[model samples]
Target: MRRNMCRNMCRNMCRNMRRNMCRNMCRNMRRNSERGPTARNRQQRNLKIVDYFRQVFGEWAQVEVVELVNDGSGLAFGIVGGRSSGVVVKSVLPGGVADRDGRLRSGDMLLRIGAVSVVGMCARQAACVLRQCGACVRLLVARPAPSNAAPLQSLGASQAPIVPSRLLADPLDLERRLAEAGHDGFGALCEDTTPTSPPPTVIEESLHHRVRELLTAFKKKLWF
Candidate 1:
């Protein structure tokens, strides 16, 4: 009787454990359904395909959709791929629909063609997908985000270098000013004559020469 009672107790315990496990699982599922997927979860899924793209491209990566309408010419974009590099846009024909659209660019990695995922697809496979696309083809590609670092670097580079106050004035102009000061042996100033005007610059000299020629011509006209 004790053995039978122990066996019945074991069965009951197993049943209770199973019931609790199912109850907890159901509760968790209900909570998850109520909450739905978070925006972060969606973003994470979106980035999963291009997560490593930044590492390869040396810039922040983003996914973009490019739609091209083929007017019987072609997609106007070439693609090349390898196992290491995966499939990427090789070139874009100038003045073509893709170029005009301006979204598709060379070096962008192919992620999808229309609704079909093209990740890990060989170049031939991607080409086949492109061939099968309808007149209006939608492409999903992973591309590098525009780098702000370049503009920042340019700004830093554009800054004029700091110069010493002493070096700021022209050396010849400084010498002329010093000579005008006429420093005596006792460091006493000599009689101050009116400061001479600076020599004319090339542009000023050219203007003066032109004025003289015009004046000479006018004088000759008056004489005649």
Candidate 2:
């Protein structure tokens, strides 16, 4: 009888330990969920600032010459716009050289690779230039200029072409341009999108699944 009692106590202790662990994990997940979005927004804001600096200042912007060491994964070319308009970075791969340095942004335009000018080169040619740089390479990047302004028509003889107060293109106009270039809506300008909801992270999904499993197990234990 004493042995059976001791065995029951041991099982109870084990059950209690597991319950406590699950509770602790749930609390930690709640804390992370509460804090994650704010941190993410701040990081995104910083990246936007970097892009803004490039856009407003263009080539006149103080050049940031970044030397990236290739680890054989090759440079992540985000988006190369057609007609040599310039390449726009769509996204930087997590943990890559570009991401680690934190200089390259999603909308930054490629200006030059080492001494080679990338101004008029197509996307294929630009990739080739990057490849030739080999193990280590320096990159010059700028923010893409606002492409919204209709080409200023030449005024006859003595008249100056009228300019709009805001040179920044309308969001719809930018979207149309992207569509015309055969982009299936991926690189929409940052200002164009509406904030709907944040996507769930892997950690959040796993935590939710674990919580559901724990609850199911608890229910089964009660039934038994």
The number of the candidate with the highest lDDT is: 1
Give lDDT for model 2.
Answer: 0.55
lDDT of 2 by residue, 36-108 (tens): 5686776664455435544554433222345688878766546566432455567898887788877777766
RMSD of 1: 38.6
What candidate 2 gets wrong by more than 4 Å, as runs, is 1-62, 144-224
Over all chains combined, what TM-score does candidate 1 have? 0.42
Worst 10 residues of 2 by lDDT: 158-167
Question: lDDT for model 1, on a 0 to 1 scale?
Answer: 0.56
RMSD of each: 38.6, 14.5
Q: Name the top TM-score candidate.
A: 1
Angstrom error of the Cα, residue 127, model 2: value is 0.5
